[model samples]
Target: MREQTGLGKVARRQGAATLNPIMLARDGDSRLALYAAARDHLRARGYEQVSMRMFRAPHAPEQNGPSYCCQNDGRIAARRWPALRAALPAHIYLWLNAYDRRGPGYYSAEDLAWLDAIDPWFALNRRPVPSRGKACLAGELSLSVDGDGELARCHFIPERLGNLYTDDLADMLQERSCPRFKCDCYIGYAQRKDLPFQRVFGTGVLARIAPEQ
Candidate 1:
């Protein structure tokens, strides 16, 4: 498929052909069809391990635009979640993180309520809420690097910490408290001291996980 071809070319160029690639699908009526195609394409490439992420809105409105807003259409997504899970291939693992309404986008009380309702569903599936004693390991354990080598706590936070090319990598790796008040993204929160992600994924938390039977 065209998508697979594009991914293959990019992976080859980046020397990441051996790494497991995750296909992200946005929530919508047609997402099932998209996921099925992606599944078939990846499996055809002899990828026994595959990961899929569902994109929800209000997280990156500046880039995703108004159409990606799930605040208003969350019920539709909630209805589709079960079927999407059921349709997954036995060898593919999937994860859904609740949207925390970041960015300049607006989320009303009703939208927040929708999030409150759906977050538990995500928890029940695998992703869990951090307990009170859990410390978020955002800046300490995870960071994002832009193409220019500038670093940030994560993609959600744009404040640059340092440049990987110019600065000492060791100094930049210091553990620090998260600047944000809340983080719901998996890449950010999965590093929480309380999450079982480490036990479940071991050293491959960033890329691979055992597929559920």
Candidate 2:
């Protein structure tokens, strides 16, 4: 599909491309944490601008939609990939991700196809990362709020559970826990056993778990 924006011509470049990372999340707080780190990382790498797209899920209003976090303009927040294609830099690297652990069908085949069609640089399906070992997420990797809307302790051994929220941003930032000496999702099975957790699952795998939006 042709982009609606003014960039008229698609400038295809030949050579190594600059990395333009995109992180997606369905949980608001998790999204925030990922985005916060990504923004810092991108800026440090010399990117001056970025874009974010967040919305209510197509079926579940209480939950968030498959969000888009990229180094584009904020105006592209609610728009689809075609619009984004027109706005992104000509020689930039891009990867599209959809957050799982929000339940099933968070991102569907149609959604992924749309992304792939618009940007050949789209990244989604990949060989599953092999399990490394039994690493916990509790305080070692993730931060979650409790049901009472309070920030829980930093480390919970991955067995303990809590309600996590973006509102506890300050505490989330200050708190840090290392349940293991090394944590690597791609290298090992560094995961949490509770309701909400994070890991390196393929986009197609995550989309299959939930209904498409």
lDDT of 1 by residue, 90-209 (tens): 545555544444344444566555454533335433333533334655567677875447676665555657888998766766665555555555666656666666656666776646
> lDDT of all the models against the reference?
0.52, 0.37
> Model 1: how far is 197 from its true place, Å?
2.4
Give the residue spans of candidate 2 off by over 4 A: 1-80, 118-127, 131-213
Model 2, 1-213: lDDT tens digits are 112111111110111132112221222225345657877676676554423333223343442443445422222443565676678665432344334333365457886677666644233222232323433444444444443344433322233233354353444443333445443322222233321223223233223222233
Candidate 1 segments exceeding 4 Å error: 1-84, 87-92, 97-121, 124-134, 157-159, 211-213
Q: List the residue pairs that clash in candidate 1.
A: none
TM agreement with the true structure for every prediction? 0.44, 0.25
Query: How many residue pairs in model 2 have overlapping backbones?
Result: 13
Residue 165 local lDDT, model 2 = 47
Native-referenced Cα lDDT, model 2: 0.37
